[model samples]
Target: MKIFMKILGIAILIAIGVGFYFRLNDDVLTGDRIIGIAVLTSAFILMPVFLYVRWKGKRLKDYTLSEENLKKMRDKGID
Candidate 1:
C-alpha cells in the first residue's frame, strides 16, 4: 500500500509536469485538457487514497475537538 501510494503520487506529479511542458511548447487545448485531467485525478483519486492510507486504523475522535479533549489540552498547557 505504501509503495502504491508513492508510485501514484509520483505518476500524478509527472503528469502535471508533462501537462505544463505541453502547455508551454505545444497546443494549448491539448495541454489544458491534460492538466485538467491530472488535477481532477489528484483531487478525486490521489487525495482519497492518501487520506485512507494515513488515517487507516486511527480513531476519528482522537483528532476532533470535544469537551474531554479540550480539557486534556488545557491541562497540558496547550491553548
Candidate 2:
C-alpha cells in the first residue's frame, strides 16, 4: 500500500509537470484539461487513499478534543 501510494503520487506529479510543459509550449486547452484531471484525481482518489493508509489503526479519540482530554491537558500544564 505504501509503495502503491508513492507510485501514484509520483505519477500524478509527473502528469502535472507534463501538463505545465504542454501549456507553456502550445496546447493550452489540452494542458488545462490534463492539469484539471490530475488535480481532481489527486483530490478525490489519491488523497483518500493516503489519508486512509495514514489513519489506519489509529484511535480517533486521541486526536479529538473533549472534556476528558481537556482535563488531562490541564493537568499536564498544557492549558
Best by lDDT: 2
The per-candidate count of clashes, in order, stands at: 0, 0
Q: Candidate 1: which pairs clash? A: none
TM-scores of all predicted structures: 0.79, 0.86
Cα lDDT, model 2, residue 6: 91
Q: What is the lDDT of candidate 1?
A: 0.89
Q: In candidate 1, what are the lDDT values of residues 1-79, reduced to their tens digit?
A: 8898789888888888888888899677888888899899889988998999898999989999999999999999999
* Model 1 TM-score on a 0 to 1 scale: 0.79
Worst 10 residues of 2 by lDDT: 1-10
Q: Which stretches of candidate 1 lie over 4 Å from their true place?
A: 74-79
Q: Considering summed lDDT, which 10 consecutive residues are worst modelled in model 1? A: 26-35
lDDT of 1 at 27: 75
